[model samples]
Target: MLRLQSALGIFALLLLAFALAENRRAVSLRQAAIGLVATFATAILLMKVPVVARAFGAINDAVGAISAASRAGSSFVFGYVGGGALPFDLKVPGADFILAFQALPIVLVMSVLTTLLFYWRVLPPIVRGMAWLLERTLGVGGAVGLSTAANIFLGMVEAPLFVRPYLSQMSRSELFLVMTGGMAGIAGTVLVLYATLLAPLIPDAAAHFVIASVLGAPAAILVSLIMVPETSVRRTGGTLEDPEMEVASTMDAIVKGTGAGIELLINIVAMLLVLVALVYLVNAMLGLLPNVGGAAISLQRLLGLVMAPVCWLMGLPWDQAVTAGSLMGTKTVLNELIAYVDFSKLPADALDPRSRLIMLYAMCGFANFASLGIMIGGLGVMAPERREEINALGLKSIVSGTLTTCLMGAVVGVLS
Candidate 1:
């Protein structure tokens, strides 16, 4: 039953993308087919290949090491609340764990490490290699290829910075591909943060988040191709340029990266507080409404009814659809952080292992309305001339990104 739903879900999702196509006739079957093949192949390579699986395991261990290192820094500043030995005995195990002091600092450490790696020329080669493979696989130019490949590790706004010179030259379809790529993947900084959050709930979570990002890239391309097929000729005039400025030294890179991460930390903190509070506020308002079948009509319940079918189609059992749907809906509407937090708090029996795994893939993206604004604002500054065009495609990119991840979930459902 799970396999049948997952297999059928792929076609259903493709058809939905087709139905949303700007020019249905322009959608290329060859591109979409290659994308599907690439996504599955990437997943199999990362998850099933023994050598690669062992490497992924090593990476997960490294994530643990990185977390411990961050806690060392935090422990000095914030003491035991950050992760040090407790001065007082705890009545409840791990009740002392604090998100601000412990989990969020991973962003700071990762930001510095990513900058050092890039500044030392370690990341450029790997990014360039990924770009080359993406170009060969997806038939994209250097600009789109670099942007999409980088989005696997970099944030949506930061990834496109590498291809800033070519932004004005990309076709609408190619431009949409960049936007969709950002929507479908999470940044490495947050990857560690999330992996830390879910490490207890899901084994080797850093590897899973990494695999989710890998799976998202090709799926983003396929969905973007379906929605806004290439109608204009792209002008690829030169080599890919990394717009990252040169730092004086590794110290400079660490200082600058920490500064950049501070901004992200503040934004994440503020946004989560506001959005989560608003969700509860709205839920309280909703509490006044009449009950349905003896169940309270909260936002989660409403979203579950709407998105359960979507999750079900992604191969979750019918009994768990509402639960999975709530997480998906929260990720789409609020953000993945909140959704994943709620998922972590679920009882052991709330979702089976398969359903939990599927939800992880489905919710691994920046597809909410919030991201649309950020993309528009960031791209507007990066290429002011393309502001109108960016505005035009902003809303549709959300749907493109959301469907892309859902397709990924369905693919994982089949393989898992």
Candidate 2:
């Protein structure tokens, strides 16, 4: 029964993907057929292939190492003299810090590592190689294609830097593609953090996070193409650009990267602190309202009501659907980091195994409201002439990107 349900879920996801594409172009039976085949191929590569699996393993190891180091640092700072020990004894006091487990340190280390790999010309080729394959099969442009591929490792904002020279020249469809790609995949830095947060809740979460990143790449491309089909525009042949020599010496890159990481760490910690407090304040306000069903109407519950149907469509069981939907709502309205924190706090039996896995994949993107503003501001700076277009498309891109990741989750759920 599960197998049958899974197969049906995959079919539904493909149909939905094509339906989204049809909004932009006439749904050619031929194109739909091709897209379905390509979608399955992507899923297979991400989930089934041995080499790809091995690569994900390598990435997971790197993330795990960084997470361990961060936890060690957190322990040193909080568990040591200045930091007070917890009333309830735990092995690592820093592990109690919500942000610490999210692998902030891993992100810092990966940023420097990725920079070093780029400088050595090792990573771009692999990115370009994947881009070439995608272009050959999916018929996307070089700049958009490369940007989408690079998004697997870099953040949406950072990926644009790889093709920084082309933003001003890209057409509406290409611009949408880039934005969608950014929204779909997360920065490598955050992946480790999420892994650590989820590890305790979901077994093998680090491995799952790595798979989500890779799987998200093609899904982003597909959904973006659907949202804005390639109309009449100059078709640029896809080619991988040579990585620029290190901006500074290797040591300089490390120092700068680490400095940048420190800033990110500080920003994340501050944001989490403020957001968590804000949520509490909001909940308190809601508590002032008259009780409904013997409890005050809270924001999270309201979001859950709005999102339950969407979760159901993703094939989550009814019992767990509301919980999953609420998390998605939190992610969309607030931010993923906050949503993950909320998810971590849920009671042990609140969600079943399948639902938990599905939610992990669904929440794995930068599709929140905050990201919308960031995209507009960031891209506007890069291509001021297209600022209006970026702003107009911002909301649509978020919906499309969030839906794309959710669709990937559905596909995975089916396969599982």
C-alpha-based local distance difference test score of model 2 = 0.69
Candidate 1, residues 291-374, lDDT tens digits: the string is 987977787677668889989999998889988898887787677877888899999998998888888899999887556655
TM-score of candidate 2 relative to the true fold: 0.72
Tens digit of per-residue lDDT, candidate 2, span 1-416: 64455456656655665565625453334544565566657777777775786676676565456555655665566563222455676785235455344334444665566567666666666655655676677766677777776677666665665555467767787798899888887876677678878888998787777777778877876677766776655333345445354456889878866675565555545544555576678889999999987978777678778777667666687778888888987887777877888888899999888888888988999887667755665566556788899888888788778877887777777777
Candidate 1 worst ten-residue window by lDDT:
234-243
| lDDT for predicted candidate 1 compared with the true structure | 0.79
Off by over 4 Å in 2: 2-23, 26-32, 49-51, 57-131, 234-236, 239-302
Error of 1 at 329 (Å): 1.3
Local error of candidate 2 at residue 142 (angstroms): 2.0
